[model samples]
Target: MISKSKVTAKLSVIDRFLPLWIFVAMGLGVALGRVYPAIGPALDAVKVGGVSLPIAIGLFWMMYPVLAKVRYGKLQSVSANGKLFGASLAFNWILGPILMFALAWLLLPDQPHYRTGLILIGLARCIAMVLIWNMLAKGSGEVAALLVALNSVFQILCYSVMGWFFITVVPTWLGAESTEFHVSMWEIAKSVLLFLGLPLVAGALTRVGFVRSRGEEWYEKKFLPKVGPAALLGLLYTIVLMFAMQGDKIVSLPFDVLRIALPLVLYFGIMFTSAFLLSKKLGFSYQETASLSFTAAGNNFELAIAVAIGLFGISSGEALAGVVGPLIEVPALLALVYLSLWLKDRLFPADVRANETAEPKDQATSLAQGGQLR
Candidate 1:
């Protein structure tokens, strides 16, 4: 078994201060935008179906490593942790969108564009960054990986449908003004196919091909260790580019961050509490609970940002809301990581942790036949 302590011991400076890196990237982006006003409009012109090609390049890099590391084989093991998976599915898919709609309606009834933005954010689920969050929180990497794989695939399938229903259908159904434009499923699918679908298949192929060539041991111990951090670097670059593109918009709205943040903050806080309390009620161990809660609470803001820009123009309120997601999510999830560690000790206790340790391993095995060693 790969020693968990050894893995933790190898933490680099980059990993230690991911939050700082994210914010610094944001600040740098804003500075660049202010310094060079022409840069944003120039970059915005490069879009196919609302997805920026330049941003897509960086995002692909960010997504690939995370997907590459996911033991798609563990998908089979998902059933092994049916309770956790089931709860996560409900939280992420069904309840997540509904809650956001309600919250946005309550919080920003007059701000239609912002409401649509929050709704879009709710529809997208996190796949890449939660792996980092889970690892930081000392949660189950295997389960986390499994959830990422599952969520990634699920997002491609559900995002457009959920978005349409919530943004256009639900509002119209409830007798509110429909702010949704012509967001066809094909457009959504195309963006998802390019952004998420390709990375997933490529990652799987890379994993299987390399493991076959180099052996499973080499793939995990050598290959993964070398390539895994690329995902985070990709995320940082993408953030910089995103903010650089939207820095002026973000800066102009002096209190908009607070305004945009209000509903999202409530969303994160409540989603986490609901997930945490539900996990405990369902008799989950610390690791299982952590994985479940993180999966539910984390929004795949990368995909959200892409979809927003695609569906709503880059300068639209929808896109800006999508941009704000990472700003709020990075720090908030970090705090939750610490909170989860505390909860694990106080709530889960020793016996529970010991008993649940094997759960992810078993799941990992079913997914990859011989997934990454824990």
Candidate 2:
């Protein structure tokens, strides 16, 4: 088994200090917003097709690099694992939404707006950040990419219907007051298309184009390293902008934020732990298990925040809850990354050979050698 110190040493400086960097970004964002309140308004004023321009840029920049690292050629191999697909679908769609709804109402019964916001988050399965988390956890990039793409398709199709049901219909079934929530399908579609579709196409095209022209050797070795660091940079950039825009709310409403954060924390913990255990139980390798866990644990906070802001207004508790999703998720998932590695050493030791067989050597080695796995 790889020692803890050895695994830690294998991570790049950026990966090693990811939590520290994210916290620093959050602090810097809060400071920027606190010092320059107008910054938020100015940023809000510049919209790209009704989405904040800065945020759109950050999301694109953040997702593109990670997506570019996906081994699209190996997708068939990942997809052939029907068990993995079915299990992922069940965890992300069925268990995930129900769990979040239970947590939201159970934890924040008094805060309807916040409860609704959390439900929206639950409906929006992750597309973007799962790749980064999967990569960091030394999971299968191919599986991560495929699962993310699958979730995006599901997100585009079911998000609105599920949002209405969870926030509106389910409450009445449970003898509570049903909230009236309406969201435009086009809006959800637009967000998915822009945030997920654009980067995905770019990434796939880049891989296909580069690998075909430059040969696999040059593309993996020379090109990927240049692009790998950008994923971290864009992630930090997105976090800063997100926090900066809502820094006032986060700073002033500490107690309320904490109230909203509690359910989200519970949601992430339960989702990740359950997924990890179930995946392992199902006989998946550590790599596939990590991919499934992160995908199951993460949410499309961008979509949740946008929908909440549009429907409930930026200053509403719903929006505040949506904003808090990533604040909690970033740290929560980072902790899970380490937890996954630790678990790998203990629970997944027997499956190491399976994982090595499932994953390409260069891909697995890249994580230890400062290259992003593809």
Candidate 3:
């Protein structure tokens, strides 16, 4: 029997208390912003190709380690997974974005800026943290890694076009008011390259190089553990800086945060539940169902935050909406992690559940010890 505590115990201290840390980081950022009115400007003064240097570093740091953990060597097998691939693409690119757009507008008809922010998040997709949620729930790591790689490619290619379409074209089609803001595809593409592309390349190179030189066993068991925790540190740093950048807005507009959170909560719940049920109906194993659920439920908040700050200014409502994303996601997904485990017992066959739990202890314990919960 996998007790709830046993399942959660695999997570590192950082992953276990991620929501608390994020809240603390938010409070700290808000306090820093309040203490130093000029902090935002001072940080913004230094730019690397138009992005603030500090923020760029934070984004790269947040993304690279998590990406590095991907098992790229197994990607060759992904070509055989026709049904899984088709289903994932449909859920992630099609259903995910449309659902968020509807929820954002339905929930926040008055707040266009925040609505736009949530829509941007939906289009971004989950390439980073879904691995953690998938792994902790005893999902198929290889499939999750493949999905992450697939999403990364699609993200680089489609995110800008999707952003333009949802933010500009859809609003016009509906005869609704679009914001005065205009973001060229080139502008968004540049942000995606700097924020998502570079780190992805670096992470891939790191994994390949290390595996070749030191062997896969050494890389996964030793190297991954050392670097895994850094991802959280980068996340906390970026959150604090983002909140500090818009501290005044966040502090004054506490209710706005709650308003933005409502659609997000609905989005996560709907996506995860639908994906789980759909995967089960399609006859995927518990591992695949859990992987699909997490992949469907999670969003690439780091990319959203970076793009929001770059295109819409650091203190813009879009950026605040981006910042509020993980605040709701961490708790929601953590609960889903437990829910996935619970469903494994009830919905899946004993034979399939037995196979998952029977995975070699060495590999499982290594991952848990290495703190792979990015």
Stretches off by above 4 angstroms in model 1 are: 1-10, 145-161, 172-175, 306-312, 351-374
Clash count in backbone of candidate 1: 5
Q: Write down the lDDT of every candidate, Cα atoms only.
A: 0.74, 0.84, 0.78
What is the Cα root-mean-square deviation between model 2 and the actual structure?
2.8
RMSD of each: 5.2, 2.8, 3.8
TM-score, cand. 1 vs. native: 0.82
Better by TM-score, candidate 3 or 1: 1
**Model 1 lDDT tens row, 100-132:** 889989988888888888888888887656766
Which residue runs does candidate 2 get wrong by more than 4 Å? 1-12, 351-374
* Best of the two (2, 3) by lDDT: 2
Q: What is the lDDT of residue 171 in candidate 1?
A: 87
Question: Estimated TM-score per prediction?
Answer: 0.82, 0.92, 0.80
Greater-lDDT candidate between 1 and 2: 2
Clashes of 3: 0
After superposition, candidate 3 runs with Cα above 4 Å error: 1-12, 15-19, 47-52, 180-182, 302-316, 349-374
